[model samples]
Target: MRTADFHIEDARGDATVLKLTGDWTTMGLNQAAIRLGESLRGYSIEQVDLSELGRFDTAGALALVQASNFAMPANAFDTRPEAGRIYAMVETLERQSAEPPKRQAPLVRIFSKIGHGVHDAAAEILLSMAFLGRLMGATGFAFRHPGAIRWPAWVSQAERSGLDALPIIAVTNFFIGAVIAFLGADLLTQFGAGVFTVQLVAVAVLRELGVLITAILLAGRSSSSFAAEIGSMRMSQEVDAMQVMGVNPFQALVIPRLAAMVVMVPLLTFVGMVSGFLGGMLVVWSQLDYGPAFFIQRVSEDPDMGTHLMVGLVKAPVFAVVIAAIGCRQGMAVAGDVESLGRRVTAAVVQAIFAIIALDAVFALIFLELNL
Candidate 1:
């Protein structure tokens, strides 16, 4: 193919005629485009003669239009319908591109983002409400048909989420308890109130840290697992297969995991509390020389610690439900792609953790109002 080139024809009494010639496809035009553009510089074209134009395309048309400073004559391609259409298309595109973009003010951009975020949040809340309704309906159905309940699945999830998670939960809460004791001892000792470290550990562990730690850990673990597991099933078409066979995917996949989570979280919280107490006791003994008997006795004297324990325990099932719901819903929303699965899994973990902390704050406010 001949490379695209143009020639300046002899002037016609104040008319500057530029004749475009040779193949004008991208392969040919791309090489000569710069040279042609430079050659046309400072020349005011009154007419463009395309009588010898060959192999026209968008790239060549664009090069010609740009080189002419976007002032191609209307009748330049009157003899060639093919090149005319291409040039016309390029003209429209170039004209649009030449227009400056409208930009918003800085404050407007900030408020615009805020408005969009609020709207998105409202939409997500509505979606969550609908999902919760469907989950409840599935739960009621499983309750009515006890035999349909996948007890094996529930037990399997219980082992994976509850039993398997225990060792880590215990170790984490234990260290947290020791840290609290260390901080308490460092502070209280200055005031000659180091003995109060026992109460500090009890109140902290039984009231908040134990449940919060367990919930957060599970949110990162079981919640992400649920999303990934169900997402994989959906991706592999197993979820669709279950639906086609008249088996409720929700009943088969979600409920058992939900039930397991609800039952197991409270138990885990309890274990975490005991582990925290033991850890704090060891710290107090080593630091303040307070014996385990004294630590236990001090904790026992505060019957209010029982109320705190109840407060923590009550949050466990709610946290569990939120985690399971977020995870399963994200999984169900996954598209048929690996990217979608990864995004959904990440969203599940983040949303579950956020929901847990926010719900805990709400609980604290409610308890404070009740003076509990």
Candidate 2:
């Protein structure tokens, strides 16, 4: 086959005419393409002549179109209708693809960004509410048909999220109690009321720190775990397969996690409370000369112990619900990618922790208003 070739003819008006020749097919086009660039450098072609062109194909059409900068007029290919059609198609596609998108004005861009943010936020809030409703509906289904409950999964999650978390929870609360005791003692001693440090530690841990710390710990550990587990199922499309099989993903995946958190959080909080008490009691007995007997006597005589402990325990179930809701909601939001899963998992932990703190503040306000 003849090799593809090109030569610049005399100038036409302000631009030159690039005449192509030879078998302008794929087999002969590679060298012609490179040479076409060098030969046409610093010369703008306003037209192309394909009359002598032989065996032209898409590759050759592309080379001619590029060498002429896609500016060839239709009449330039008077003797080669097929090559002209190919060149026209390539010219249209290349010119369209090579054009850049228009840039928006700065003010328009700012408003566009804000609008996108608001839209995304609204969509997210709606999705969260829809998932919450699904969870509640699943819960009602379980209540109406107890057999729908996944007892094995619930037990497994409880053991994992609860029993496995005990050591860290106990240790964290213990140090917290010890630090509170030290602060209370140091501050109270300045006012000649050092002995009351035991009461300070007792009330703080029992009323707030114990349950609060447990909730925060579970938010970090259990919330992320729940999101990751369900998000993986989502990524693998196991959740979709369950749906195809007429299985409720909410009851199967979400409820077990919610049940696990609901059942285990209170037990964990109770353990945390006891650990805190022990820590503070020991610190006071050793440093402030307050014996175990004196610590117990003060804690028992304070009528607020029962009320405060009840208040603290009451927050456990609500906090558990928040953690489970945030975790399960984020999990269900996973978009079938590693990046999506990671983002949802991180959002689960962050939103759970923030909700817990905000809810704790609300609880504190309600209790204060009620004089409890």
The numbered model that scores best in TM-score is 1
Candidate whose lDDT is highest: 1
Judged by whole-model lDDT over C-alpha atoms, candidate 1 comes out at: 0.92
Pull out the clashing pairs in model 1.
Answer: none
Error in Å for residue 203 of model 1: 0.9
Q: Candidate 2, residues 57-139: lDDT per residue as tens digits?
A: 88887877776576566587777777778878878788778557799999999999999999988998898888888888989
- List the pairs of residues colliding in candidate 2: none
What do the candidate models score in CA lDDT, each in turn?
0.92, 0.89
List candidate 2 stretches off by more than 4 Å: 1-94, 102-110
Model 2 earns a TM-score of 0.75
C-alpha RMSD in Å of predicted model 1 compared with the true structure: 4.0
Model 1 earns a TM-score of 0.81
